[model samples]
Target: MVDVYLFSGFLGSGKTSLLLNVISQIKESGRKPAVFMNEFGSLSIDSDAVENGVPLKEVLDGCICCTGSEQTEAQIQSLLEENKDIDVILIETTGAAHPVEALDAIYSPIFADQLNIRGIITVVDSKLWLDRSRLSPQIRALYMEQIRHAHLLLANKSDLLTESEMATVSMELANYNEAAPVVQTIGAKIAFSYIEKVLHSTKEKSDTSIISGKGLPLSSKLITFTESVSRDDFEEWVKSLPETVYRMKGYVPLEGSINPHLFQYAYGMVSWLPEYVKMTPRLVIIGEGIDSIKYE
Candidate 1:
């Protein structure tokens, strides 16, 4: 049986970073592993971060928990058929995906018997979790469910918190998920030994509680802008966005630049990748109250 490892988390929780690390360790052990990435929006920049040698497959523009289930299953079946020699598979789900729905998709009659679930690891942003007051009730519930159903919970970005804050975050996460052990790490840098033990151990299977009903309602908005933006203007606009806006990503040509720059804004934090030409330049902003954000 091929072992399937699923990694889940909220936006900017470092799922890709953790997946890359896990892939490297699996490769070192002489096991053949394949990667499956699910993106919430159409344009994806995460798949490019994977190492050159790892086999990568991507599902874009939808959440794997809902309309993307059939597509996800198809991808898995195809992956197995083409790479029959692979010993393991790694699936990195979108931040908004509910693990229960993903669990159901993976355990369908088509794959339940052929694949053994090695583990479901959910990465949580310690700082984000600490300051979730602005999040909608539905979003909060979704986030809690992701942590509750995981086989392991990683409270990443620990360096952002003080010692007292770290303890508080740990305690709250413990309250949310007593079933899964919480591991703290800086920059999602967790040792493979701990991960290996969790994946290979003979612990009891996770409870598939099916807590998410009617799937997740689309509570966020996705806005796109095609106009070339000024770097200073863009930065200022991003800084002025309301707290309701959670994540923004896209490529846009900056003033006085020949190539477009990739911009990512997560919870008021902004990062710009080196200028490069990739796809049509446009921005996708996802969050509540997106209309309130003025992009001049």
Candidate 2:
């Protein structure tokens, strides 16, 4: 059984930056890690922050997150079969993905006993959120869905807001998801030491079982950044993102290899280690307040 963590965030939420930071921490700790990335674009991205890049040929060759659940299930199973050394499994879901569906796809019967779903981390863009209020109905619904299902809600890009504005955004998030802890971070930066440790057990506060509401998009203005990467490069890129967009994720293919790397991020905070087969490295950082775009 492997420890699995699902990293989810809307477009431009800094998921990639977070993935890189978390991966470095995992490596620094002397733990072998494999990153599973689901790039929604044709030009697969790679993470070059590390010396050893993650290969992509080994990962599912398509859109596993949005295409449906069966393939996604097969993707996880296939990875387990190909590489058994994976100590922890980190899933970098697509930006357009519904956080719940990402979890459901991996929670298949085959993986149920083998993998433990520690928690769900959702990233939200404070700037985008403010705009969500004025977006069309379909878009608003999507924003609500993301916030409602978060186990840990990252009120990212806090630097963009004033003290009073920060409180207002925090209050708004609480209204939709009072269950998760809404922490502010910069550059999606966070210490990776406790990511998996903290996620191993689900926090009672972020439970979505009590949530009621069928997700229905009210607008199409919701944004997301879709790409792939090699685990190593992904690492540096994520840390760099701590200053860029809001979120990023997907797998990174190590250079001169076929096996794909996996990772994810929210705002600027990183969570969980990427694992599959064998790999390990150590790096950790915790950003205070909202994540700055530079972290993206």
* lDDT tens readout by residue for model 1, 257-295: 777777766666788887654544655544433433445
Clashes, model 1: 0
* Stretch of 10 with least lDDT, candidate 2: 216-225
- Considering every candidate listed, which one attains the maximal TM-score? 1
lDDT value, candidate 2, whole model: 0.56
Model 2, residue 102: C-alpha shift (Å): 1.3
List the global CA lDDT of all models: 0.72, 0.56
RMSD (Cα, Å) of candidate 2?
Answer: 17.6
Give me the runs in candidate 1 sitting further than 4 Å from their true place: 204-296
Candidate 1 versus the native: TM-score? 0.67
**Candidate 2 C-alpha lDDT tens digits along 76-151:** 7887777777776667777777665565556553344455455666778888887886867876776677677666
- The list of candidate 2 runs beyond 4 A from truth reads 46-65, 201-296
